[model samples]
Target chain A: MSNRREIEREAEHVLRELSKHLEEIELEETYHVIDAESLRADSSPELRRGFREAALSIAPRRDGAHYVAEAGTWV
Target chain B: MSRQALGEAEENLARRFEEIERRDREINSFIELNPHAQEEARRAEKLGGRLAGMTVAVKSNINVRGLRATCASKTLENYVAPYDAVVVERLRREGAVILGMTNMDEFACGSSGESSYFGPTENPSAKGRIPGGSSSGSAAAVAAGFADAALGSDTGGSIRNPASHCGVVGVKPTYGLVPRHGLIDLAMSLDQIGPIARDVRTAALLLEVIAGSSREASMLDVEPQPYSQRLSADLSGIKVGFAKEYEEVTSPEILGVVKRALRRLEAQGAELVEVELPNLEKALPTYYLIVFVEFFSATRRYDGRRYGYRIEEVCGEEVLRRIMLGSYISQKEYAGRYYRRALQFRSLIRRELLQALEEVDVLAGPTTPKLPHRLGERLTPLEMYAYDLLTVPANLAGIPAGVVPAGRVNGIPVGLQVQAKPLQEQVMLNVMLAAEGRA
Candidate 1:
């Protein structure tokens, strides 16, 4: 895997090229943030049942209570 | 009386399943058959509702408990849904039997259905041409008579594109009109699950059942209207707007059919008005810039530990390309330049559509710029994105849009897209009903 520095460098290169392409289009609209409604999560029993069902269907690499993950290597 | 109706529906359901078994090898519309469909049909026979005994094929991206919700990607090829999507629950509650999971573009990314890991769906209307996608199978299932109707998500023309090619009716309901609680979203802001069926009434009926406020707070909170009840064949004094900008981009063959459709509406006593949509050229760019970013964000959940496989390693080329482009566009440095600008432009497109709808009851245009090409034909990603050019504006604007079989070009079906203001699905469907009558 690429290190942080390498990933940042690649990202910079991509932004440079992409920005140039976007610059060709002249935008007439001024910047303004459109207000989107905040999502309200339901904690009802039905929703809990749905979540439990989804967790059960997730591809198995999990313990009964928690998902198992690959151990990370540290430098 | 209900028992007799149930018996008839069971017969119809059995016949449809058998037909799917025989012809689906060639069509490839379905990914997995609901093993409990016959059992569900037997149960549906006892239920009473508008959709009682109807076979509804759901696109694989939408969750149906005990069925693989793959989104036609190898990444989730074995991932069975544990819960029904809000729309699926509503449909089942109303007595519709879930027939199977239909194929779609992997992660709902590609327009040409060929990006599906399950294989591209064949257009039943045109022998060798592509079933326009990413709702390719849902449209094909209805067109092929495998289902009475099917539900497909429309982010940017996923439902209408295939509906046009497969000669079926498809609706991309106003954004947020249908709850998205269980939809495997392509782009959260743009995705709305709608119905594809052989006729306008069935599409409208399914839309009525699936749309409106749900237990989840994701819907628009608008009081649902009886959309199917309001559909009318009458078009007297109804004003239909024909956008000149749509004409500039559409192919000559496709334009020929749409023009005939406009004339038919005129002959039916509907007044036609020429509307200017100056920002049509910019819509495609604006649509993709937002979708790419939103899609990228949505796919972050596909890490192998939780889902089937890590998306980056297993996704199709089109999906990978979107993720990369989205990642590039969403960089902190470039977010204002690309992503923010696209969002601002979205407002402009929405404003233009809202203004146009104030003048006309509905806006009519060709659903796709060109007819679908043959499967396996190589196209640049830009070419594939162009398939949604006409249909994306509605998604961008969060307006109600529907497609009806207008006419055919070279024996392949072409659709006339109709659009109305948000929450005005009745007007859009009435226009579609009139158009279907003309056909």
Candidate 2:
């Protein structure tokens, strides 16, 4: 097997072992639910603008009003 | 109160700045000292609110306008915060001087403070050992007296772990009790921006200011209380719970310190109770699974085009591991077996804790399962993950938890952790105050 493939297999084995310990934890009626609507409230325009400017100022590459992003994966 | 007193305060503040600069050269606790700190301290002295005359160092993950919120990663090496995080704003409003940003594990991923792109933060209390992380520098700054108090975000023991190892006070408020507006996310569901201080009262004051309803972010519906005023050393009639699971996992030396501290509480009239949390052992896996998924989702914005470097390209080994694991688990093929299962287990752990709390007023345990490993120790990933074993359950349960200096083992600090039900911070603080010998 390729070295990369061997490492991948090892990782899988480790993850499997970790998951095995949690297997006996029986899931009851509960689900991890988040309220999407409550998280959607609008901020004041002044606050929004301040956040926008701060975010925009840090962008490494900017074109006019848009942040220019690389199109393909570098890795 | 007088002109001479004000002048003296200013003189003291200048000396503190000099001390921080000189000492931090060796400790590496601070990432950047606030250039405007002197002016801000002068202003705070004049303004005189609840936190006036207090100097606060913020963890790098929490934003302070005009300072770099690097999260100690090369990905955000140059990313300056555009605005104050809600907690920072609250502190500024109440006349607290923002000292500067402190270092942390790269993207808050490591148990030890050694993974920062800037450099590792040496433990101030335990020389030649790691300051527990990712709130490493926050706790260290307080330990080294560089700041009166500091702000650190706890996802799973980030604040409390360092607080324990460094012999300071750290509080992780019940989830949503503190607003998360300015914090860069590690795991939003579990992350809480909280206070680290030399004493419980200062931590309570910081928590009071930062924990409230905010227009900028979704917060818990509960009203913030005057936690500082509510603190008392009296633990009379309070039932302190201990889980066998916690005792089972903690190292003998640290556990001995924690038990003796619990006896101190008992001396002050608190009753001890044994509580069963059958699902406690499963919390670590549950926490990491949830963290991995949420962290991967949160890092999608750092795609190299918009802000910082692509995270996967610039992040440390631990970070890359989580991102890859999260990506793999999130795939349609494996999501159910891992991520979904983890969520369900999270709920089980939460239920177990809530049930345990119903039988007792608070739970006590060692903050971390073991003493901090020596700096530069070659620890496996599992060894690093073990540090969160005792700390993660509170985050999972969305409860208030804190660490108080229990005593020392071999001159290394050990913390006695006290946890209370959701939104019951005052009760937890009282127990911690008793642990601090204020009783």
Candidate 3:
């Protein structure tokens, strides 16, 4: 666990060093925009049910109608 | 097909299954065996798809119905894929029988194949060494003859690095050239699912079968071409770029092997031009920034409710480190300085590679800077990230790049990487086909 802590700290140190070089690069917001055209195929209820069952079959805990998860701290 | 041919196909598959059962424990290449593989081989006789009787090993991160699509992490160790990935569906449509899922780095986070929860996958080429990863198991399985070909994803050097170490053929097709509908993304912008096989022609055939515009994914609009068709061994008219900067980061043994391969290409009448890709040094840090941020976003789905475990609790050191770094860089205060700058650097990298490609048909270099080391050998995260130095620029540029086994140094394999412009897999494959004969 201490090794994990060391690795995390090392990673943060490297990121800060990397950010220092960002001043050399020009500021640009022109990120590559992806084609948002949807090619999603509509699935039938049978397919939907199969996916639901597949997920539910392996859920750590589940009620009949829903997957049971640990209560959120925020909520 | 004749009955005799069908029988031969079945016999071949049976032998492969037997080999896996007998020797796979030592290599740890495969994670699961497709229960329906035998049935699929039988069905191949009646099918008319291009890959009618081929056996393909799929990376476990890509969904295969009825098999768990674990990213070699405990987080999804028991999560069964509800459906086939688009690539898998395409392969099945072409009548390729899926062998099973191969192992990988946890959440596709590591360069060496040692980070898997199932345990490290041993290199088939060098007995005690690691298999370069995150496509580690895919390359190993192909090298061990457990499958005719395998599918692997390259976010950076994942596919080609393993292919190089395993002494096999692997291609990382142009970003957005192959559909990523089912690939578990390490970095959404950089991830490309590609094919690995024993020979260039087989890899090209598998790529042909898998590459196209998908109904649910954005990909290149170009008509799929027969990449393996009429590939000429003669390199008379081809211009090959040799970047001098690659030698600075590459080990002497690997550089020797790659230089010799370049010489062979030169002998075949290829014009070797000295090219400069000055932005190459910046690719490593740039690649990591994008990957960490995107992977952090991708892994948010694994909150223990839908997957096998909460990633933060059960993931490996590499995965946890990336998540932490990603979370840090994504804060609004740091986003402009780190993530946005990385994107800008990525654009600069793309322009540099494209400009180089205009002068040459393809760029040639060592796939990885060094050979695989012994499993469990200690390497810092930056040292591990260095493995992708020679291979990441292609991913950043969104270009087609492939690895063909060039030669071996001291019983370990080195690969010659051939990179071409986006959607120019044909050029890449031809270079690979020529190198396959020489290598």
| C-alpha TM-scores of all predictions | 0.87, 0.88, 0.89
Ranking by TM-score: 3, 2, 1
lDDT of 3 by residue, B1-439 (tens): 3555645666778988999999999999998999999898888857746777788999989999999899898889898999899999999988788999999999899889999999999998989999999999999999999999999999998999999999999999998889999888898999999999999889988898788888898877756778777566788899999999998989999999999999999988899999999879888888888888899999899898878688999988999999989888787534377787888898989999999999999999999887888999999787888899989999999999999999999999899999999888888888888888677
**Superposition error at B10 for model 2 (Å):** 2.6
For residues B1-439, could you state the per-residue lDDT of candidate 2 as single tens digits? 3445544545666776888878988899999989998898788778877877678999999999999999999999999999999899999988788989999999999889999999999999999999999999999999999988999999999999999999999999999999999899999999999999999999999999989898889877767799999889888899999998877787898888888888888999999999998777789988887887899889999999977698877777778777777777778435388888887888788988999999999999889989998999988677789999989999998999999999999989999999999999999999999899431
Q: What overall lDDT, based on C-alpha atoms, would model 1 receive against the true structure?
A: 0.88
Q: How do the residues A1-75 of candidate 3 rate in per-residue lDDT, one tens digit apiece? A: 558879778887778756665566565577568887865556723346487788888999988958888756774
Q: Would you list the rank order by DockQ, best first?
A: 3, 2, 1
- Compute the lDDT of residue B70 as modeled in candidate 3: 90
Docking quality class, candidate 1: incorrect
Interface RMSD of each: 5.1, 3.5, 1.9
**Model 3 native-contact share:** 0.36
> Scoring only chain A, what TM-score does candidate 3 earn?
0.34
Task: Write model 1 residue lDDT over B1-439, tens digit each, in one string.
Answer: 2657767887988899899989999999999999999888888888767788999999999999999999999899999999999999999999999999999989998888888998889989999999999999999999999999999999999999999999999999988889998899899999999999898988888988988898774667877778888888788989999999887899999999999999998888789999999879778878888887899999999989899799988877777777777877777635388888778788888999999989999999899999999989988666777898899999999998999999998799999999999888998898898889566
